[model samples]
Target: MQNGTVSMAELLNSSSALIFMGTGCSSAVPNAMCLIQPSDPPCSVCSQSLSIPPDLNPNYRGNTSLLIDHLQSNGEHSYILIDVGKTFREAALRWFTFHKIPRVDSVILTHEHADAVLGLDDIRAVQPFSPTNDISPTPIYLTEDSMNSVGVKFPYLVQKKLKEGQEVRRVSQLDWRIIESHHEKPFVASGLQFFPLPVMHGEDYVSLGFLFGETSKVAYISDISRFIPSTLSVISKSGGGQLDLLIIDTLYKTGSHNTHFCFPQTLDAVKTICPKRALLVGMTHEFDHHKDNEFLTEWSKREGIPVQLARDGLRVPIDL
Candidate 1:
């Protein structure tokens, strides 16, 4: 753990990359509703998903999540995961294996929604099941409210105890670390400094986005309906006033959502942040990756900023 602030030189030299573990909404792409209904043309995006391999199919998305792959100066490969949503098992099986990623070094959660936190138990796959195992418990970073909800949803994980007269069952051994999202405090996980960018998910609920990286700034806002002024200020104050990459939530091609950004809202936020490059995530079946990307390509040409939809399994290396 970096107990103090790290220098820009140290951060620049340490190799790291971002992985889009999943880029779909709660139901993921190829929505069950669309699949069940019989239509003349059918759901174009959902239909194409059936014919291609997942690695090659952008239409085949999983729940929104990100993985930070960092190669420390000491030669340790750190895998810091963000938000283990309901589709986390499928994401881990497919993306982790395909990318050859090892065990998760830590987990940073966005919020307590079922789509974001329901897969907490599945993380046990990477940890030692038996108490005698030598591996240390995985550290989990989340806000207090998120932890409270998590406790209600998975009492076994928080308490880590067997009930009276109940058989022993293995659960994920996690060290809960609460980050004060309201305070917008910065925390270091696996050697990277992450600034919590709190945004409104709904009128009464706030979700966290993250602004991290040193030489090449990257911001992630995977579940936000609207950006609060504080988040915009943080983004504007980032290195040299330029964000290298931004992966944000875009729930639909059009129309405003109550808890997720639609196409217009996403674009408004993007323009406000003015990132050098942007990738939209958390999309429903309304978007066709190829078609939507073509549209974004033209928009990028006109705006002079790159914008595209993020897909599951995409890895973006941070370069100098």
Candidate 2:
């Protein structure tokens, strides 16, 4: 498994980067519950999400998603997407235009939840081009259990025969590859290697985090209530125990949830992993981005590790 770790020399270009497609929880920042219901005082975060010059609005988020623009040797780009959720179309309309992303080369699913997999039907939007979609089927990597859930939820996506009568329709042409669990070996996607880190979402359900990149090792666990021992071991053992970046789940400011990391749990995990830099994601409308980020900046100084919040359209360069 530790055969060939990418060397620092390979990262001199330093052009590769990760773009946050969406950084909000399932409902997003200004969801219907918050907007339509309109609490007496009105949700401050949801209210501010519609501020003028929306590009600068951190609160306007879609479901948590990550796009890795891996720069290839021939000056080409490989776009590997992680989690196309319930708000995939909306996120795409805004982010794809803002970032000028031409296409999505591959997809990786962390779990089977609606926040992670509902966007499967929309993959056709970026397979090759907009209207034609005449390229090869995009490869999607996911665990067997998650794939089972997908098969149950999206039977036609897994098997074309299920939609035999609907062959005329141009559904998302996808290639499903059932991968093993976190304990299994690493897999390659679009020339980049990724190691799955299995984590507990709730008591019975499990989701995946991923560790990827060459010199700039980044560990991204977008949804997790707890980190498993085996997963922690892999994180510490890899790259001689030095992780460049960690993007983790921080569902709320305080209080614990059964399926996601809260503020205190996020602090604990950050202390353990001790990455050079950490960015929190999967937030609800409860957090004020500027306020929380300001607090986190001071906290990062105290902890000696730069930590902050990730918002939709935020991009961070990484050495690849």
lDDT of 1 by residue, 1-320 (tens): 17798875465336677889999999888898777884788888888767887778989989999999877767667889999999999999998887778789999999999888989999988776685333578899999999999999988778765578877666778889999885258998878778888999997999998888878888889888777876787785352387989889999888888988999988887887789999999999899998999999998898888999988998887841
* Segments of candidate 1 deviating more than 4 angstroms: 1-14, 129-135, 160-167, 182-184, 237-240
For model 2, name the residue pairs that clash. Answer: none
TM-score of 2: 0.90
Question: lDDT of candidate 1?
Answer: 0.85
* Poorest stretch of ten by lDDT in candidate 1: 7-16
Q: Report the C-alpha lDDT of model 2 over 1-320, residue by residue, as the tens digit.
A: 13576554344234788999999999887766877788889988887755645577898878999999898777777899999999888878888887777888889999999999999999887765534435689999999998889999988677755444553456798999877666567898898899888999998988999999887888989999988988887676342486889899999898999999999999888888888889989999888889999999999989998999998999887877
Error of 2 at 287 (Å): 0.6
